[model samples]
Target: MGDAATPLADTRRWLERAVIGLNLCPFAKSVHVKGQVHYALSEAQDAQEVLEDFTRELEALVALPAPERDTTLLVIPRGMEDFLGFNDLVARAERIVRKRRLEGVIQVASFHPRFVFAGEAEDDVTNYSNRAPYPTLHLLREESMDRAVAAFPDAAAIYEVNMETLRRLGLEGWTALDVGPHA
Candidate 1:
């Protein structure tokens, strides 16, 4: 998080070792291999700046077809480190999506260094699935998502499957991947 490239490097590693390697995101590998994933590290120091930058990225995604740019990783290297604040920022981000009339066309997914599920304990291993090297706003295309889900067998079970995978990996195994916390 300190260096300029740290976020991207850590993020790429997380994708490689955790997301893709563990098969957490079945669709990620294909886009990644095709060089369609856009990773943009934002240098914004506050939420406002991050929001502006996020809007720009969202627009950028809209400009390109799904094949050229499937999704975007707007990684904020600063601000919103606290999960509560980060969650609030995510809400604002969604508002922007709706404001831009991209509600059904684009959606925002969240990833944070300290992501936690509503009912899960802070140390729950399941949260690691949403943890990223930095606070990232994942801008996804609705149509692409629908296509991916339609093709994925039992798409509704992804969450349950991911939870089970993390449960088996445990805290030690997650730490071994060097992606995030053990607690």
Candidate 2:
């Protein structure tokens, strides 16, 4: 929203400063450093168009080798401003993966500016773990995820660690990151 490059720039900052800096996802650093992550900007103005964009990104990701493109962040700068609507889009995305019979090969993860855990309060800092500057669909390869999980000694503990990290950081600390659109 800030500019033509705002979405991607802010996303990269969020990934580097929050995701990697906080060690939220232990596996992200490697692919990021190796430049295997793809950043796709969607010009869709509606859910239907967004889904179309999602399908294209999914196909593109699977078409390339893991070493070439391990993952993709389909950034939606228009439409999908509502979290609930974004959730619906995510469901549709999941169905797309299943329909293509790529359910086990690829996965769709959602991240939004207003991401909130089911039971958590909207203002909870922990929700920031999945929040992004704009609505985003994180397409990840199952094989890469499996390899990363296997390489990590305690992959299960990563979630707990992220929770503690965010709790300690608090909203104030999150705002300090300046990765969000408002920030």
| Candidate with maximal lDDT | 2
TM-scores for every candidate against the unseen true structure: 0.95, 0.97
Backbone clash count, each prediction separately: 0, 0
* Candidate 1: segments with Cα more than 4 A from true spot: 180-183
Q: What is the C-alpha lDDT of each candidate?
A: 0.90, 0.93
Overall local distance difference test of candidate 1: 0.90
lDDT of 2 by residue, 52-130 (tens): 9999999999999999999999999889999999999999999999999998899899899999999999999999999
Q: Using TM-score, give the best candidate's number.
A: 2
Off by over 4 Å in 2: none
- Give the worst 10-residue stretch by lDDT in candidate 1: 174-183
Write one digit per residue (lDDT tens) for candidate 1, span 10-102.
Answer: 788888999999889988898899998999988998999999999999999999998999999998877878999999899999999999999
**lDDT of model 2, residue 37:** 95
